[model samples]
Target: MISASSQQKKQLQKYTMLEGERKQGQFPLLEMSHLLYGGKDQFDKFLERQNFFDTNPMFKVNHDFYNKSRQDQILLNAERTVEAMKKLSLGDPNYYTPNVLCPQGIFISTVHFAMVIPAFQVLASDDQITKWMTSLKNFSAIGCYAQTELGHGSDVQNLQTVAVFDKQTTEFVIHTPNIEATKFWPGELGLYCEFALVFAQLQVDGKGYGVHPFWIRIRDKETHKPLSGIEIGDIGPKMGYAVKDNGFMSFDHFRAPLDSLLNRYIKVSRDGKVERQGNPKVGYGSMMYMRNILCDQYTKFGGRALTIAVRYSLYRKQFKDDNKQEIRILDYQLQQQKLFPLLAEFYACVFGSIKIKELVNDNFNRISQSNDFSLLGLTHAVLSGAKANYTYFVSNCAEWCRLSCGGHGFAHYSGLPIIFFEMSPNITLEGENTILNLQLARYLLKQLQHIVSKPSAVPEFFKFLSLETVKVDDVTTIDNLIKLLGLNCAILTKYAAQKLMTHSDMKESWDTKSGIALAKAASTFIPYFNMLCFLDTINNKAKETKEILTILARIYGITMLLNNMQGLLLKNQLNSQQIKTLQDTRESLYPIIRTNALCLVEAQGLSDNSLQSLIAPKEGDVYMNMYNFASKENSLNKQQVHNGINYIQKMREVNAKL
Candidate 1:
């Protein structure tokens, strides 16, 4: 190990070097933060929350926490999470921010905040909400959204859990009809929550009413013990989220009050009668909300992952040129190629998430106030595609960031491994990326058909499908690039529609077989939408900000095009010469982006305390931080002689005697 004094000297030198790099940026970093946070006041509020969490002991974790056994990690996380909630008074007005509970990035009680509360807010009747909302908001009763079963994940329609009404008792007897009906993969259900918003098929008078949400208490709130007829326990450790107690649950004729049915959309009467109101699709509102939130989460996750990699790349030096001075990895063309494009992607995700949030909120309000369900289908299609596409991008880019940092990334202290693992589940959860993309394609084909029937009545977003293709003088401009993507989506959607029409007699089987093509058509539209969002963000900016953002936007658009070159060629969206030009243009944008990379990452407004990566301190004192973290906090380094070494020595002695 290097001596402490030597480490300190190296750290100081790197810190000085990083400062010099920061000074070279063309724009003020704070201005970028303002843009990222939506406004200066919002950025200030974020900082206030971040500072509060940083100073609170309940949110702090030892560096060696990562070295603990999974059970120990879960216990620590649970204890700290509950303590933080109690002190912070979660569920109060604006009290729950994503970072406050999980400062180190592992989600604690996320199901309670993201899934359970939203389930109630969207699905529960006003009377039911009034009865239960107080207890929920006070954290007197914790809950999880239990929908996925052992046999069903994305296929919610096929879930086997059953809720049969008992007219005599005025209750619903919820049961796991078979082993496949056991609820699985609920975030807080295992050992934390006392209740769940369980999804099961409702039965009234021996007739099925399809799947619906029911609030069922599974555990004693005071005792934290499983209640009668409820069997619940944690699933084993996963690739990540060691801290989360993701659980499985089985019910044996579990009884819940008749009011337990969240009946804002549909209700069950005491005499076993059913009253259906509003649209059946209103049940999907909670899911759309969560998917929108996931988009925002992806932006933050991608930003932090890139921040760690980019900052470290600037501080870490390798291979010396002929001058005998080692070069920073960020200066290399290959490194720039890997890291800068992701920075652009991070920005795109940030802006795209903002747009999605606005769209979802506006549609939800219109649906609630005016009972206008006309926009629900469009909202679902857009949010589902955005969730899938953004999550996939964040997951892949996080892995790229990890790989770019070399071996240091594999270590827990680097922060990349945790981000990659935590974000990986997003691709599968909310909705599986491929399945969601296919659903988006179905929606698109329907929209295209509508446009064909009524060209002048197309939705604003889909109006491009009705436009005639015009020859472009400059293919590199954002407008032309977006047009090309729109053309590609239209072409792909048309082909998918034709295939569906040809197999109308065997629609189910045809859809199953053509799933891949349908998913690709959906995937093409996401980047197009993302580019539109990015363009909108820059269109209203000041001259300097616009120039920088335009560069980043072009980098994002061109990189996406090059990566999907085969699809573009197959659809004839770009000729060979245009593809070559895109490649060359992408290469030229790298250095311009790299020049502003540090400033862009700094603009994310992530504090060193929240990052908790030894190699990515804002001050750039990585060598010293690594030394202190390993020497002081790593359990393996605390002793001169290891227990394993002694065990091996005893075994060797016994072998000699034998």
Candidate 2:
């Protein structure tokens, strides 16, 4: 084994080699990356944010952050949040900067900004905004999105927390009837947040109006104690995303003012009479907002995971070549296959996210301008599938990146494990993948409802549904792969619609029985939509980026094809030779991608401080960095000396005596 001193001495050679590798790229990677960031201006913001986080002592991870206890982490997160907000507000209040620059996963403040604030932005009335927006911005009233209850998550319509409009007092009495009705997993609610935009069943004159948003103050501002009629506390540790302060809260006839109902589009008189002007589904504005936010987050987080995996795979040398020279792990075909496809998928996600966000914004804007919710259902359907598919797939990508790191990936020091914690919960939160598939599947079937009568009225995606016969030839190109995938969806949708029509006699809906088919149809749209978006992104870009991006998009399409092979094969959409073609195409592209692997990851511009991986430093000083990370009180070059009185040695002696 090399000594610590020797590891330090060889670090310079590693840095030189890594610099040479970084300089090997042919494309203008830095300029090309601006497209992923939205534009050059946004990329500049990202760089500035990175510099601030990297330089700020307050933001620094001085020790093993994963080693911190929940309470310690909470304190650290709160402190950093304050400092970050102060600095972020000094010039441009680009709220997105915090989320994009946050080295850690979603934090306490992230929920406030991403969910609660956006919800208010889209849903709150002018007066309501005037009343509460200041409190939210100035940190006088930190807010939590209290939506998911212990029993009724995803089924928002069935939530049990009731806020009844009291006729005499003109007040809404909010109550959580049982333990299961408690708001269970809202971030920032456990300790820090003082307020919540609570979702509860609204009752007026004994008639129920399904779940509606209520502005409720849970804790006192000065003392930070739960209010008289509310019970609030932390939900404790979870599978992942534990760094954020997810918490539980319940109410005991909590009396809030009539104005607290967030009645932007509706009004309630003193006599408990309800007046409304807009669609109630428009109340889903908040949910829609978050789903869009998550689409972008998947790309960013996926990029981070691939950055670590790709960088480490390059920096760490493994088995020797025939010439007795140590070979980089990335030199191997298997490593390239594992990482490059993920790299490609990350780009696809980038393009898809931008498009999806734009679509969501357009939908919201239309509604805001004219109360036009005609396209709301369609947009929601798409978002439901996008959230479910993207989160489920990208979270798995992070895990794949972890696994690709081999045994060392299992270690916390590699930073891949942290990516798992950051990404895994996204699959379940917002909406669970299976349930969301069913939701979108239901919407897809709705489109077929009128297809037989008014065929041309159906959306472009379902245009193939009316076709008598469809034939897709060899899938040599990305477009062909996407067409094959689209054909698979058309088949699944038609099959599902037929099953429903034929089996209307069943006790439950046919969907309950044939849910698997519905989910499969929904899940596989994953690649089709992303491929289209990626191609669109490529078409809009200049020739310089279009070259590298087209190659990446092809690889992404192939990877997605391989992943859906079983479904495609079972559906007869892809034949044996076609599948082999896809495999061959992916393999052919690997070397070309490997040539720019370091360049591609570098394009993501992830700071070493943000990554926190001992294995993924830009300088490529793997051994020395690892040594430094393990030095001092962490585990200095000291003997394994005993405790208080050399008890380990004494125990050995005692064992000998025995």
Candidate 3:
């Protein structure tokens, strides 16, 4: 059972200014507790569940059943989590939300929900869905996603596994031609997954097509051992997600019927003619779908870190004041400076995530009914860029949150370390950030080229891009700042896109000859996309908020523009004085942001319970909980070893001298 002290310790809460003072409003500790529990219980009943941490029915089942039984249990837990996901949808009024469950839990519970079920739901034929969907939903059968290969993870077009169709047997023989073709890095694949949504090169009648997912059995039904022609094993420890059974597999002439191909979107006939529905890119829609959800997922990622950091900040105290009272570290300008900007970013990401979700849902609805999918390609392109930007920014800020808390920040108890570990993997997972940014660059280029070919094709947003030169000559005002931000992004969007098109025919412009060249192209384009993202946020802020946000938007834009300031100077587009003015304008914006540091953080609707760190919580009796925690027997036991050994050695030396 949970001790009273432990229960009291975790009854962490915060209060904020009223809604008139802040947009997202303030959730009191009681309200937050309600929000967390979906209105079922008060503090007393909530603590009761905390007692069963080691053997909670839900928690234990995930480990004992899913982690141990491996394949079958993986599917089981996935189905449970899928049910949980439906319960936890934002649209639901009474969702039982946990504290954002950490990466280990998120991966263990969500891999199947997010990766496997969706692949089958979107890809499988009606008959296949009839056969498998219910079993998948009920957890009688389990599935894992298998697309990333050991050698070619992000490059979808270059995977080496082959599924050649046999006319006589009417089966597709799945084969791993070499060790490099081995499927790797699929979560829960080694032990937990019974079947896999396998992506492999499709060859029929001597004609080859690119990768596609085929549902294939991976383990025996009764024995639970690897099936014939299959080799499966763990990929060993990774930096994060230790509990997740991320694993590797190789197929040796595995056989499945011709009907195994997920034919909802794409189909291979006996004659080898390939028929596809709507857009060919729709076949690769899982990645696109995940990328869309990642915006909100990443916001929560940063919010969790911010929660830890903010709470810790409130709870940590440094030097005593003149009255000999300790001051909270959050009071220090340097501390606020280090963390508040990131706090604002967390808020921006939250709002941005909401927007993206709306966009994705609306577009999906349109595509479903009208079959007009012009937005699918655009949504995919926009989201891939935005996801990369937000994840990277949030991950970087999480590290800074670590530094802000000093020594305790490094401790696992502080929670920043885990948050960082969880978030850092995102830079590479869905799509490598750099390569994905370049994909957005292609979209931008496509738009610019269309407008150039037909001047009437230009979006009104691109009118600034059409200008031969963009000028920043106006006097300073908040309204002007906001306008300039939008204008700046439009110009950059037009310029970069047009530049790529003008240079597209030159082989040297698209050179992958060196890492430096490749990185330059990626770096140049992502900032343009990020600028647009920031301006998009700036446009939505309330008047007073927008005034401040405009400053931040200007700083963000000017920072990118300054990277090529020399080019701007050489081309006579910017005088030295103008560059200095922009720098001064950016430097000035930081202080205006600094004054409202506490209010800004609170406005994000963040609570001390949410942040769960030393540096970011509500201003309070800082260090009381931390000191109590530090003074605990278990916590002290960890530090006791070195102190105890030193004392013993000292005593022995003194006795010998006597």
Best-matching candidate per lDDT: 1
Q: Model 1: which ten-residue window has the lowest total lDDT?
A: 92-101
Q: lDDT by residue for model 3 over 1-658, one digit each (tens)?
A: 9899876665442233122223322223343233222233533443442333223344431212212333454455455455445434422211222324423244343556666776776778788889898788765677788888989987888999999998888889999999889999998787778888899999888888778889988999999898999999889777765556788999889998888898887887776677877465554466766676566655566656655665565556789999998876766767765765576556545555555666677777777788777577667766776778778877888799888878877865566776787678888888888788777656655665676687666544343334444455742343343344444444555545445446645455544323333333334444444445556655644566556556555555565565534334433556668767766665566666545444544433443443444334455333554554456523344555566788899999999999
How large is the C-alpha RMSD of every model relative to the true structure?
Answer: 2.7, 3.3, 7.7
Q: Any runs in candidate 2 off by more than 4 Å, and if so which? A: 1-11, 89-94, 97-100, 461-474, 505-507, 540-544, 565-571, 633-658
Task: Give per-model TM-scores.
Answer: 0.94, 0.91, 0.76
Candidate 2 residue lDDT tens string, 1-658? 9999887777667777777777777678867778788778888888888788899997664546666677777777777767776677622324455454464545457777777887887667789999988888766778899999999897888999999999889999999999989999988888788889998988888898777789888888678899999989888888766667789999999999988888876678888778876566776787887788778755577888888888888877888999999999988998888788888988887788888888888888899888787668878888888888778767877899898888878877777777777777778888887888888888777776657787767777556445333466657566776776676666777776666666766436554677777787777676778888888888866675777888898898887767765555656666678778888988998887887888888887878877778888787667666677777525323446535457877888999998
Candidate numbers, best lDDT first, in rank order: 1, 2, 3
Q: Write the per-residue lDDT of candidate 1 for residues 227-313, one digit (tens) a residue.
A: 989999998878887777789999999999998899988888888889999776777787886798788655588888899999999
lDDT values for all models: 0.81, 0.78, 0.62
The 10 consecutive residues of candidate 3 with the worst lDDT sum are: 90-99
Ranking by TM-score: 1, 2, 3
Q: Given candidate 3, what's the lDDT at residue 463? A: 38
The model with the greatest TM-score is 1
Instruction: Provide the lDDT at 101 for model 2.
Output: 48
Candidate 2's TM-score reads 0.91
